[model samples]
Target chain A: MMTTKNGSWKIRYILLLIALPVLALLFSLCVGRYVVSVPDVFRSILSRFNENIEVSKLAYITIWNVRLPRILLAFVVGSALSCAGLLFQSIFRNPLATPDTLGVAGGSSFGAVLSILLGFSLIPLQLVSFGFGCLAVFLTILAAKGKNQSMSTIILSGIIMGSLFSALVSLVKFTADQEQQLPSITYWLMGSLQSATYSSLLIGLIPIAVSIIILFLLRWRLNLLMLSEEESCSSGVNMPRLRMVAILCATVATASSISMCGQVGWVGLIVPHMCRMVFGNDHRHLIPACVSFGGTFLIIVDTLARSISAAELPISILTAIIGAPFFIFLMRRKGGWNL
Target chain B: MKLEIKNASFAYKNGRTLYENVNFSVESGEMISILGPNGAGKTTLLRATMGLLNWKSGGSLLDGDNIADMPASKLWSKIAYVPQAHNRGGSYTVLQSVLLGMTNQIGLFSTPKEKDIRFAEETLDRLHILHLKDRLCNEISGGELQMTMIARSLVSHAGILILDEPESNLDFKNQMIVLDTLTKLSSEGIGVLFNTHYPEHALRRSTKAILIDNGKVQFGATPSIITEKNIESAFGVKAYIGQFETEHNMIANVIPVGLTKDEEKTEANEEDSDVLATLSIICSKFEESERINAILHEFNDILFGRMGMPHRKRNLYLISVNLDGSKERIKMLAHQLSVLPDVSCKVTYAKEEES
Candidate 1:
């Protein structure tokens, strides 16, 4: 039964969602190549503040430098992508809408590959990718402008732009040297948090955090966006202005997340639906629920990606492997897309 | 508050004029019904008056101020719109859905406060749907959903409530519930305007009626404007106008008989003849006088001479009318008179002479 008496139960559910990610973060910090015990992990983390605590120097370096940034980056990137997906779905009024529906991911992928082909360093590569991701959406918007620029026209233009940029990505891949560059490009497209560093984390965090805050403040209005354009307008919402702001915020979040982690697919699309199953479709609860559940889900997936075998698998492969079955299970249990 | 549309004309982008020189005014506490056939620009006129559509000429004035110049927030604060009932499927609960109507009242970043929630609750209680506050909108029946929408609009405290066919696709009880709610709202000094296909609903509830047909509009009091002739001309259907005596007062009913195809030919041929008949209509009781009056007024085109006398002691009204038209017209008038329950009529035709 879907109860609408929102009281202590809602707060309890939200607290549980928040606790899951924190627990996942703790577990992920212990599951790397240099396995550190839970107590030792805490000591290593605590030793950063307290010099009196005796912890292994290797454990300190491993936990702080390698696993901590990777875990935090995965959580941030996941939360950013899922919230973007939620916003996009609300604005487009389509349950199937994702961050990449507006060509952001495709454009960023093209940019990342082009920068790699140009032999740019990691920081510049991510910057170029983020810039092109925004540019792709900008161009899509430009293409959709006309005498009567309907929502369908904008979505259609996004599809066209996505395909165009994807073709460009393939062209870049084709012209590159097959031995070193091609494999690197392919691995990069598959997505991983293996290169997570403090500088790279900082680079992605600023935009993601800003966009997230903006979306959080605008979350209540997102409920109105679920209504028809006429109803929203009649209800005193400036539909065009709100939609543009939402799109800009979602695009920024998505582009920044993709720049950090090459293309973590399905986290954006699936986490919100999963959250909706737990928390009802009201955006007030649904946005925060998506954030917590998404971060937890990706952290666990990243942990499994690094710990599953002797050679680490890409995060995308593990996400698809885990996410597809879970999605099918949700479909079977829920019977249909109630949202 | 008065919403006045002065000589408004609207043309579509395709150069098709939907309506021209449409003029009407609705004041606070007045219920106006826009009655017409499909494609008659009833919805178009409503949208144009609300400034949803750009009109070629003229404008809508609210309390002598142009509505176009007012900001949307201020405009929406004063005017609430309840669209058709079919737009009801959503995941929000009834209270949450109704709270959305306070969008203008609440700031952009703030959520609905306790006062706003109390207002929504009071509105739901007023509409007798308070028990449905926690139910998801999609889980409720269509009638309940319609009530929820009305409650939504009511919470906004809008002075003018415009509904687009609030009773469409509803069962008899649900339709009555919706119509009664609308009437109650209008009686509470909220100017109500609704467009509907049922002329009987217009006759029963509306203080004023606007009949739009073939790009032209006829606006006047409901009883004077919505007649058998207007219904037939507007919808290409023959209508019978009659009245029923309720416990409190007499209410008129417009019943559609069927479509008429050769009306133009019949009208043209009937104009050439002059057949005179005298109709003596007797209402058996005094309470049936209103029904008799409505029937006389409905067929007044052919009725030339009319006189009425009430037998006070016996509680009866005897009405005598002399009608001049073709033989078919006189017969049609007599046929209409014979249908009332307590009314009887005797028609005496003059013998034909060489002219």
Candidate 2:
């Protein structure tokens, strides 16, 4: 049952959602391992435009170079993964779909493992990882559409293709040297944002940003993708084209984010579901909600990952530790999920 | 608007051909019903006619253009389809769900405009579901959700409406609500085509009916196609279409009593010889009178004398038509007139075809 909601509560709700990511970004910048005071952080950020306001060189370097790019990358990867998750779930009409639903994570991890074994540098490894991620989706589509086209067959093929890539990754891991390559492979597979340079951000930004923007532009039609096949087709949309474009975009976003940062896992599965719990299932609200809350959730998690201990913790560990319980609590209170 | 399927045939891969060379035309202001047993390809015909599925050899045409050749957006903007309610967990609010109907009208990067939303609201209001605008679609009853889906289709401003089992999961009253809405929409000059499992519903409401039994398809005027013998053969049951005389008019119904245990062909359609009769009609509204005129025009060759008198004070039109034709076509014309809203027609024979 729904109460007769006035427009005032809706306005307040939208404002609160929009504010979360902005506030999280600010809070993340000020309270890190090298703690810049809040006012000093704002002053230093503003000092670049006005040089008359004196700022210490160390604080300047730490705020602008170290924390800014890292947290910014955190926002990018976070939103990208969650948007991908939301898109896949709508496309498959299944609540359990994730950014890795089409095997992008498995395929990209195998590519990264192979790259490390072959002693390839960072850029080539990222490219190889993205290329394989796309290849996995392509193969899944081909297999699913081989004889007769159906949604259930596609889901089955994705599961098969995903496990195949995971097995291949394990084979590569079994072949890597224990002392040098294995530990690095294992660590990277656990996921990290420590290598979030400005260049890495630039590379990862294109696919994620472009796809997210395109998806936002075609936001309402995303609702149609969740409809049954006949219902969707009759809505006067070019459903095949819409479906192709959406799936391609979600794939690129998920693949590029995995290539940029290793495998920050729980944010993709949890953030979109959290948004649905709060905002309901209208894509007009769900898309923007996923973008904002996803970015905010990851910024907070990554901030804690870097600051909680002397050595950096894997971002995925923090995400599960924080996200799982919160997700469970929200589910219980909200009384379960629907799409 | 006219949607025509010409020589279209369909079959699943490595399976029996469902039907061959099926052809029918549905024009604007006409209500057509499709009745078939399970697995008779009732739904598949609708899908292929809309080009959602490809036919084996032939295809459908909208006006003069082939449906398969037109762009999806162009074709769908002119033909709205409401599939059967699936009791899905989709939680989009009723307003938002209906607003998605304007997807093809809005641009690639645009949300629906204020004008589009107003149209959606007006459509829901027309369907009497305006109060449920902010309610979630899944949270409503099956009938409400069915109406919501129909409203979504109507908001597209399509000239032709197709529905697949729009009344299947509903109670008697809910079925009447849906069927009456469709009938009213059809009278408003939008071509309405729907698949129904209830033969009585088809015979009672449709201007034309298509029956697909096993792999054979038959299409004709509603009364002629949904005869008692046809129902018996199609459904494998001993059934009869009985006329129940009410105070206002003669309403026809189908009663299925028992299943057939033996395969015996019943040649019971031999009583359609020439006869002379007069059909008296009372139309409560101008629209119903106009519909009556259209139906009478089709039998003008057999009709001889016609008279119309309008009582302005009472808001009713009293008319009588003399027809000299086969018993089948005359009864069909009377049945067509009787099915319309606020229209009652009775046939009185001058020369009866004796038993």
Candidate 3:
């Protein structure tokens, strides 16, 4: 009976996590200034298949060109950040670890601000930010080497590298044009999905999807990374190779997401933790749970950010506001941060 | 399957040799216990044997193939390792934890199959912890946690299991339970190699004992290897090895007294003239007379005068002896006399010039 109960609970949680996102995607597609009905949204989508089905041209452009790409971008970016977060937590064996722990966000923000100050085009800006984010992680690893490669050493080096990158970002902001460049750079740092176009979605989706698939496929071995270095090695895990692959995938996903959407925080850190609390810490279940819940959670937050006031708010502001209180609730409910 | 460590040597990066030329082999259905004091390289030896650390000289062979040449997954599938009890900390259920041992059996990207789950269940049942299968590992007692770890290793279906101090943190009953489980596993044809601080445990459960002292290793059958002389030299303590009959069979126990410091000091003063010592022996039961006689006969070189009186009503034997010998020799004779069951010996020494 207990065995069956456990098996059924896992299946049910997985189904709920997956279904909730699809439902949220559909629901969010309806809630906006225009307030399209759910059936209208479905009819608009169905009109693509049956040309005879009558749908307004305005609805078609709003749904297909505007809302769909933005929502899809939000979902991909959210799930990518969450997957990177899970990878970081497992490989570092520290629950507090996130995609930003290795200075990816800080380095990418600096690169974005520098590009804005130099009057670079949008594509070059994204490429520059992605390159700098990866470079920051590489430098962090280089600093952490030759000290037995302990987790604490790597974490300490990451903190130092993160601070250095943040300082560089501050320097870039200080030197920018006060009227034109500074405000734009500050707004970009706040993070938003408002600029989510079909091209931006296409650019970020492939790497994020590829990385998430890799993480999902290797979910079982991710459990081994939770063990100590010696224990994992003795258990037949190639610790260095596994860790390198995981970090590389996580970095690619995080950098691509940040380069597209600027610096969206808290989703990466909090989504994985919330998933762990609900579905236990087994990565096989935890990874999918994070992907689903994270995608749905960000889409809802972005919807609220857009609708909460007349002017749109940045996605990061809403995520931190919601994420901080929920994290506190989780900590209080669990009695302490055991992780 | 057989595991052989042939002339294996290990040293730290700073050039201090932890152990050298350590040679031993264990086969299926055999248990080898490594005994040593704290910081005696016991853990290092185990790590070296498991290939967690590379050896500087020589290597291990599994079934005549070099272990180093084998892939880690292949070698680990044949030889499972369990770290110390304290190192296991997590929220995985007993079932999930044990299923982790199937790391090698399952594909890198694949979850456990139905047959892997069945194997894991059978392993838990074999360890008699099937009832704990659903319980979280951290919520279980330490002894139960230990059992789960062993079950985890067993689920891999490894032919050999190497544990580091499996009984260190447990209470007496739990210690016995863990040891007994290991013994049972060995009987089922799985080789068990563990390091422990308790020589009595090694004597009871281990088929072979390896005593590492001061960079040297002594390996042999448990009974022959765990002798008083070896124990004294290894641990600097005087020990007595004796056998007692239980309802089932005879069991050997090693009783270690404090270090032989007094004997060493007296031996330093051996140039002094021999002393005349008088030893009074009392036996509460008549059955102990033969053992007391044998003990005295073994020390006959120091015997000068001996007298025995049997009190038939009390069924006790009282013997008194005067001996001329060095203080060390006299003390050894008295010590032997005191070790016999139901017998006690007291000695009085008086300095005398040689005549």
Candidate 4:
């Protein structure tokens, strides 16, 4: 009886995951200002297989240049952030850990804000932000070391570094021109996928996809990290190499996702917990669940953000609106938010 | 299954050493109990054997192969380690906790196969706790927790079982249960080493004993060869030694009492006096007693070399004689004096040589 129920649940999860991207693609094409019918969207996507069939130039342009890139970027960034969150949570053995828990978001925001005030291009600003975010996470880890750095120490150090960086961002905001410079900085902080283009989307996909693949391959090793260091070592794990690879892979995922979506809050924190709640805590099933649910969750949130008003609401604001109450519920129920 | 530890030493980062120059070995199908006072590095020794601590001086060799060189998975397969079970947050079922013992057997990418489940079921059955397997660990009695730990160790298919204080913090019934399980395991040819504080516990089950004190191996011998003097030196205590009636067992019972300050000072003062002179004073002191004739008879026994008195004990009491110019004669004098109703006999040893 248990086996039968487990088998059906596995199939249900797989089917739901496969259907998500298709639904997201259809929603992205059909809900925009130039709304296309679902039948038209399907035909336009399939016409590439039959090149002899004539397709409208406008439909081709929307599918190729406008809508396709946004949907793909949302999936890539959602998967990256959720995977990063799962990695950090497992390493610290805390369900509350997210990409921002290590000051990655605040440091990246500080870099981007500094660049805008200094009149840098969007490309150079993103590069600087990504570089600074990785640097901040490493420095936080260093500050937390003792005889052996404990997980709680690392987490508290991350909080300190995050606050320090946030203070610097506030200082940057204080000196900027209110009408011209301030609004752009504020908009960037709010986070949006409306600025996504084919070029930026392709660039973000490389690091995100690579890191996700690394996460999947190292899923087995991640379970060992949940144990104490002595247990992990005696259980045959080469502790140093496992730690280095996991941190580097998780960092790549964090930096790329942050660069694409300017601090998309709470998806990373919430998705892993939701996955663990539905599935068990074992990373094999949990990691795949995070990927599917994370993307679907963000796609639906993004749809609400864009379709609710004439002007698209920032995705970050919407995540807080949903994530705050859910976060409280998770804390009360699972007792997993101690970090 | 010959486990040999030679010249093993360990120290913490703070420069306080837990153990140094330690050496011992145990053979297959043998039970060796590590007996020590509190803070005598018993747990440290167990951790070193389990490869949980970083050691400095030497290594533990299992059948001539260093434990450090063995692959972790194969090493665990040979040695089943049951860490001291403390309180954890969850109320995971007993069967689930035992299932976690099969963690290494289950591949990372795979679920538990039928064989793993069968092994767990069979272990619970062997422990006679199959009905309680579905109960939460928190809901069971302490006796059940101990049985579950033993069952967990058995499910690992480990040939050598290492437990730290398995009998500690357990009620008498649970302690006996754990000891019985260990005996059954050893009878099945599994090498077992466990740390214990109770000598009787070790004396009851283990054929061999290793005593540790001040981070040194005081004695490593079979139970038959373990004498009162050895235990006294190892634990710095006074002991009474005798034989058991039924089993020809040489029992060494240790008593942990030290001399009071005044008693210690008086013992130090008696060292300067000549033995002959002190015995002469004791004989004169008890010369006029009604028990004098009885004292003379015991003294004659000492004079004939049939019995002897230990030196320091003769000085403190008033009923010894100086006939042989030694305290052995004085002990005979005191034994005779002990028969008088008013005269009490007390024996003492010099502080340095007592243990």
Best by lDDT: 2
> What TM-score would each prediction reach against the true structure?
0.87, 0.94, 0.84, 0.73
In model 1, pairs of residues that clash are none
Interface RMSD values for the candidates, listed in order?
2.3, 3.1, 2.6, 5.0
Candidate 3, residues B1-355: lDDT per residue as tens digits?
A: 9999999889998889888888999899789999987888899899989888889999999999988899888898899888887755457788888877788778888988778878888988988899998887778999999998899888777899999999988999999889888977886788989999988888777868899988888887675567676777778887887655543223567887678774563222136456788988888888778868887898888899999999889999999999987765775666555434356667777855557
Question: Whole-model lDDT for model 1 versus the true structure?
Answer: 0.85
Off by over 4 Å in 2: A1-14, B87-89, B267-278, B297-307, B321-326, B348-355
lDDT of 2 by residue, A1-339 (tens): 112345786687789887998899889988877888888898899999998988889889999999999998999999999999999888888888888887888888888899999999888888899999999999888888866777788888888999999999999989999999999999999999888889878988988899999999888778888778877778778787898899899999999999988899888888888878777777777788888889999999999999999999999889889988987887798787767
Give TM-score values for chain A, per-prediction: 0.97, 0.94, 0.95, 0.90
Candidate 3 local Cα displacement, residue B319, angstroms: 37
Write candidate 4's Cα lDDT for A147-193 as tens digits. Answer: 77777888899999999889999999999989889999999988988
| Clash totals for all candidate models | 0, 0, 0, 1
lDDT of 2 by residue, B1-355 (tens): 9999998898877866878989999999889999988878899988888887788987899998998889888898999999888946378788888887888888888877778888888899999999999988888999999999999899888999999999998999999999999988987888999999999899889999999987778999898899888887788988877778776677888999888767676765565578888888899885567767887898898899999998889899999988898878888888888778789777888855367
Give the per-residue lDDT digits (tens) of candidate 1, residues B1-355.
9999998899999988888898999999788999989988888888888888888899999988888998888888888888776654347888888888887788877777778888888999999999999888888988999899888888778899988888988999999999888877876789999999899888877777999977889898776577777777788888898766544224567777788776452242235477788888788778878867876787778889899999999888888899888765665556445534456677778888897
Candidate 2's error at A150, in angstroms?
2.3
Q: What is residue A109's positional error in candidate 1, in angstroms?
A: 1.0
DockQ values per model: 0.33, 0.55, 0.31, 0.08
RMSD values for the candidates in order, in angstroms, are 6.8, 2.5, 9.2, 13.6
lDDT of each: 0.85, 0.87, 0.83, 0.71
Scored against the true structure, residue B238 in model 4 reaches a CA lDDT of 47
In candidate 2, the residue pairs with backbone N, CA or C atoms under 3 Å apart (3 or more residues apart, or in different chains) clash, namely: none
Best by TM-score: 2
Docking level of model 1: acceptable
